[model samples]
Target: MRKRERLELIKKLILEHKISTQQELLDILENAGQTLTQATISRDMNEIGIIKIPGPDGSYIYGLSKDKLRQEGHRIDETPSILAVSPLVDGLEKMIHVDVVPGTSRLIKRQLLTKYKEMIFSLIADDDSLLLVAKTDFYQQVIRQKLESMVVSDEQ
Candidate 1:
């Protein structure tokens, strides 16, 4: 598999499982049919900004770095609803457009890129809008659904 695909899988595994050691992560990957060396996994984890955070039982578990997310303007304490006001999401062909609160387009863009990097070809953001070019029509629809789900209704 390609590096991007492998990285995506690693992220998913880390998020979905309590992976503590490099050996444990390697074993899980091998069980899933991914054959990679521990050195390569370590490099990939570093490249993707994954870090060991304190788990529930005081052990360290692999997790995405909150510092990196904060540096990207994504507040770890705030949800998407706080950054956007009923964002308008629309898509056509292989492109998806999202309209969010002014000054928050960049944050939303960063979130989208982080979550859907493999599906996205290019993403551009202005003061209150974003234009994402997906790798395929299917990816465009998937991205549209994800953006739409983040929309908060004024009624709620």
Candidate 2:
């Protein structure tokens, strides 16, 4: 499998299983019929910022680092909310909370501004929440409209 696909599979397994060692990871991949070398695994681990955490079995298991410090200068403790939105000409910032899956936050953060360029400056995303800081009220308004439109009604 390609590196990108392999990495995604590794992440899926780690989230779904109790993996504590490279051997276990290797077994998982092998069972899935994709072989990987230890060196490749180690490199993938470092690239993805995987870390070990204490588990109930008195052993440390591999998992993604959820620490804010590991995040790219975005403080997770910062309770982000849509503070305000002003027109671009008026000079204001907009903020909003986006509820998304934890694993997809990084992917969303990478291209938010480019994908939605109307009024976003930056984004701070965690497991299930994203703080979008808009560069102008126009952007804020646009984002709010998009979000509201995306809201799904509970129905059969």
Candidate 3:
């Protein structure tokens, strides 16, 4: 299937069912006669700005951004904070993992690119999340704090 079609199916599945993981989504697609891999689904989710929201039972389920849902009057149950996803800090590797709301990653990346062009070694994005590799611990701290503040401000 084309990326657009695949993304539409994903959105439909999420709206119709509580899809919690990439594997579950893949299974659903396969049962519907579409063959796809977990990685493909992940990339598609990223492309379409899908993020995981906390489900009623505590597990996370795929959700559209508030910007998309507002017009439809579907309320998102939880408001995510920057720390809700838990940043994974790897001191040994000088890398930090940050989970952001979809669409926000691109904004964050653009801002970081302009501000930390020299200190950041690399920035990788996947769905509503990103990994930042810094040239030093100082850079990592700076980037992490700035990102956290940005996310919080956006949520407000």
Each prediction's TM-score versus the true structure: 0.46, 0.44, 0.55
* Residue 128 C-alpha lDDT in model 2: 48
Look at candidate 3 and tell me the lDDT of residue 144: 71
| Residue pairs in clash, model 1 | none
Alpha-carbon deviation at 151 in model 1, angstroms: 36
**What C-alpha lDDT values do all the predictions have?**
0.75, 0.65, 0.71
Off by over 4 Å in 3: 65-80, 84-119, 124-145, 148-156
Candidate 2 TM-score versus the reference: 0.44
Best by lDDT: 1
Per-residue lDDT tens digits of candidate 1, residues 65-95? 6555676675684435223323334545887
- Model 3, residue 13: distance off in Å is 1.0
lDDT of residue 148 for candidate 3: 63
Model 2 lowest lDDT segment of ten: 78-87
**Candidate 1 at residue 22, lDDT?**
90
**In what order do the candidates fall by lDDT, top score first?**
1, 3, 2
